[model samples]
Target: MSTQNYLVISALGKDRPGIVDELSKAILNIGCNIADSRMTVLGGEFAILLMVEGNWNTLGKLEEAIPALEQQLDLTIIVKRTEARDSTARALPYVVDVVSLDHPGIVHQLANFFSQRKINIEDMATTSYAAPHTGTVMFSVHMTVGIPADLHIATLRDDFMEFCDTINLDAIIEPAQR
Candidate 1:
């Protein structure tokens, strides 16, 4: 593995089809390899987040390309070099995926559960889906959590399961390797 630096880029604006095509083309034109990315429509708006890797000195290439990209797409772009990617890598991270029928208080219920247990949430994405015409709704959440090695996984899972049953939700926990 290369220990070279990279950049984390993110952007958000009104939802429009083909935003991905435009952004990807821009990054490629500047000669950066995208290492990882997530682009989705969130609340009537399109949002894009990406990790780009290239020689550390080529950052100027990105800066120059962003302004024209923003003007062409009418979207805001934020980019930051990942010079300290491992600064917080001392602890292992675990991912918890939760899915349940749409209902009030689902997010708060699950988020509060983690808060009370002192779990660190690294990243989370929650979205609600509506069944066409029928109007039925469902909610799904994918969250990456950081659990210290000393934490007991089984006990934590059992505790969550107890309430998951009453809420009609399913939860799964898995370790994410560095």
Candidate 2:
């Protein structure tokens, strides 16, 4: 039986076409599988995060080839081995949406509030754009948070709404469908 080894790979470089193709070809050549990944363009840079799976020999081959790829692509690459963890099936998932006039401190304050309450943010994305007609800069955030089973959902919702009100943000909280 082949022993499964997991590798977490992260890379960042100037945004350009063919980066994914090149990296993917390299990974495939080494016989590793791209199990999960997230890639996005942030400003002028392309950020890549991937979880790859293979046996020891394939993983070693990929490791040896990484330096040449990094040099060729002008990328900063980091690779790490990670142990798998059990999924949090017991945690309740909630979608939190917030929108307000663009300003600093909104994200920090929101993160702080959740952190203080021991909430876990699973995924979050934020964007800024000009509002229609008014042309005022507006910020919007969508996040998936994990609420522990012991927490009271109604109480949490009430407190979150009140906090948003105090900060002049329009917000909504609802269950995230699986």
Candidate 3:
């Protein structure tokens, strides 16, 4: 079997209607497939991260086209070649949810907690909003972490809860749904 070539592209620009359309069309036209992507508008800016798959020649073609596409779409585009992820470690996926009064250092502290335990945080997102009824500012964090298969879940849960309690954060850790 032939090996697949991959490119990770990140683009940022002013929010506009046709950026996705134009960018996707360009990829399709270049004979590359978007393997995975995340696109969102933050404030007035549009940001996109895409992992594209193709053969070497096709991906090279896409790379050559990036400069023109950036100008046309009014975006700052970055492209990097990458290999597919290695899944040999086979870590179990777990989801962590946290809510608390809005404040700084939550993410850093949470990251430190997992890091100390040698857990890998695969994905995370955090948001802040006004709480209902009281209009109190609230923060929420959702994270997917890869736990080593040999780790004791019960002990980890106990420690995680204890840490959260000490920090005045409501949190839960559970296996990720397949």
Candidate 4:
């Protein structure tokens, strides 16, 4: 019987063409499958976080191959064994949208509010752009938050709205359609 070995791998380095090509080639050479991943350019650097699965021998080969790729590509790489998790959606999902005039600490304050309330932010993205015609700098955040089954929905919504009002942000919380 052959059981799969799962790994969580992270790579970060100066952004350039061929980073994904080279890194993925290396993983493929060892017969590993890239199961789930997130790749993005952060400032001048490229960041990658991926989960891979393979058999024992292939995974061992991958361990030996990573260091060479690090040197050749000028990358910082980290790998760790991870237990496989079910990807099926669980818990109630809600979408939180916020818009406000550009200002410091907006993300931090919102994150703090969720953290204090034990809310899980499953995914989030933020962007800054100039409002049309007005030329006012505006910041916007879109996030998917997972609300635990036991939490009272109305109370959370009320509290979140109150906090947003205090901070002068236009915000909305609604159920995320699956």
Top candidate (lDDT): 3
TM-score ranking, high to low: 3, 2, 4, 1
TM-score list, all predictions: 0.75, 0.91, 0.97, 0.86
lDDT for 101 (candidate 4):
100
Question: Each candidate's lDDT (Cα)?
Answer: 0.81, 0.92, 0.96, 0.91
The TM-score obtained by model 2 is: 0.91
Estimate candidate 1's alpha-carbon lDDT, on a 0 to 1 scale: 0.81
RMSD of each: 3.6, 1.7, 0.9, 2.3
7 in model 3: Cα distance from truth in Å? Answer: 0.6
Alpha-carbon shift of residue 74 in model 1 (angstroms): 1.8
Q: What is candidate 3's lDDT per residue for 51-93, written digit by digit as tens?
A: 9999999999999999999899999999999999987987999
Q: Tens-digit lDDT track for model 4 on 47-109?
A: 999899999788888888889989998999999988787556456889999999999999999
Runs of candidate 2 exceeding 4 Å displacement:
1-3
Give the TM-score comparing model 1 with the true structure, all chains together: 0.75
Error of 1 at 30 (Å): 1.9
**Which residue segments of model 3 deviate by more than 4 Å?**
none
Which residue pairs of candidate 1 clash? none
Measured with C-alpha atoms, the lDDT of residue 73 in candidate 1 is 91
Is candidate 3 or 4 superior in lDDT?
Answer: 3
Question: Backbone clashes in each candidate structure, one number apiece?
Answer: 0, 0, 0, 0
Pairs clashing within candidate 3: none
> Relative to the unseen true structure, what is the C-alpha lDDT of residue 13 in candidate 4, on a scale of 0 to 100?
99
